[model samples]
Target: MNLALVFESGDYVLIGVFLVMVLMSVVTWSVVILRIIKLYQAKQGNTAAKQAVMESASLEEAAKKVQGMTAPIGTLTADAIAAYRNYRNTEAKTLAEALPLNEYLVSQIRSSMSRSMRQFDGGMTSLASIGATAPFIGLFGTVWGIYHALINISQSGQMSIAAVAGPIGEALVATAAGLFVAIPAVLAYNFLNRSNKTIKQDLDAFAHDLHVRLLNQKD
Candidate 1:
């Protein structure tokens, strides 16, 4: 409707707030979409990798089976295979030599697991920050709107219903705008965080299984 008239009277404070909300929404949705795609790819790779490991002759074969997989589990599998090849070539013959080599391989798996988890958590902090701050930002706009309305009334020496209600409505709209930005942000943050956690948990178990598989190798 008369967007120009609405923001014109408020010295463009509401317009500024609206723009900020729009930016936040854009950013939040971008992250949400990207993460969903990445996570889905990772989850699919995970299922394939699990089947590969179960069906293959050895852990090395499993890694080879799932070569060039997607992120998260793909990275972990590649690292495990690399570590397996490196240590196996060392030709550690005795129990003592093998024990140390196995420890080294476990360390490699942990490092790889940590890196994957970090990647899974990417963009989460910014999502949380946007959800937390958007409401207060809107409230700031609302507070300023009310203050501006009071100034307008004092200057004009008129406390008419039309004058008072207009500014208050403008300020209240700020609160509404804030909720608009915050709600979806919070919902997305929760959903993604939960899904990431589930993936992380699966990775943790897979790392353990990989550790056992690598150490059990009759190299």
Candidate 2:
């Protein structure tokens, strides 16, 4: 009924299921912890970079201030500045270059934001996979364990409640283990997803302000 009994008495397939569940749980927690730390650092860096840019009175001053910043906002600001410069300096006209300065700048800044958000999406796919599949995997282990239990009982001809209950209970442990691995992954995925959206909103607002400043400031 306990884990020790399950491991000792269960066949190789059942044992393999347990080991796989353990590995999935380990991966889930590792990703959750690392992602949280990364997001925290990114938020702090973004806040500092936002303040630095806001305090600057001109585009040139903002550029210089954010030059050394490691935040996603710094990259966004750089992209905005580069887009502005490119639009101004391009004397040769092309179909793609026909867009207004604000539109061009907005496109470049949005691309930078996308790249930054993608970095935070590192382990999300795996978290989703584990959340979706862990329970089914545990059920497979349970079914396999019960099949072997039935086979053993058939050979021995012992149909007692004691014999039937013990193996079935042990088999159900795999399903329980699966749920244990899956629930936290699901919760963490939801939490991290919300956090990423909030960060994206902050970046979007910063990008908008930067665009307005770049348009208004005199060269």
Candidate 3:
């Protein structure tokens, strides 16, 4: 059937709800796609910063190169470098003197990483909510449609398929609309979750390496 005909044939209220579902689906997918792109870019930037830090001769040079990168890994590296520089400048005689400074820097890096993670995690909650509730919303439309269909049958005292088909078909459309909204949302939610995990892993690894490098510098 043509799109316009299907829509015109359906109960107006159900059609309205279906349109709303379509809007929600579009919004949810848009967020998923945008976030994925941002995360991918962040990942690529992190990789490049890691390589640069590993290859650089001195921590100061590495920090300078990475300072403007702004990705989580680069920011952590910069923080570590700053902490090491501060410790060296102070010319501490023992680990006791250096330990406090390093701890402070690690704290800063951790906070920054956490904030980045939260920012990346945006829109996931909305997607989850939509995935969970859309079916029920559709079911509500279906139930409404069925109720009206039965009311019509009672008033007309007829059992003909022609008399019943329109309302029943309209009701089923709600279920279909709900599934249409929900399926993509659920899929996107899962995919985005896995992507977030991967990003978190990379961030954790970078943080660990930076911690080790900072500790070694103190010795």
Q: What is the TM-score of each candidate against the true structure?
A: 0.89, 0.94, 0.85
What tens-digit string does per-residue lDDT give for candidate 1 at 21-115? 88998999999999999889889888887877778897657778778776676778888888777766666555533667668777888888888
Clashing pairs in 2: none
Error of 1 at 139 (Å): 0.5
lDDT of 2 by residue, 62-110 (tens): 8898886667888788677777877888999666568987777777888
Candidate 3, superposed: residue stretches over 4 Å from native: 1-12, 83-99
Please give the clash total of every predicted structure, in order: 0, 0, 0
lDDT for 7 (candidate 3):
67
> What value of lDDT does candidate 2 attain over all alpha carbons?
0.90
Name the better of 2 and 3 by lDDT.
Answer: 2
Which residue pairs collide in model 3, if any?
Answer: none
Question: What lDDT score belongs to each candidate, Candidate 1 first?
Answer: 0.81, 0.90, 0.80
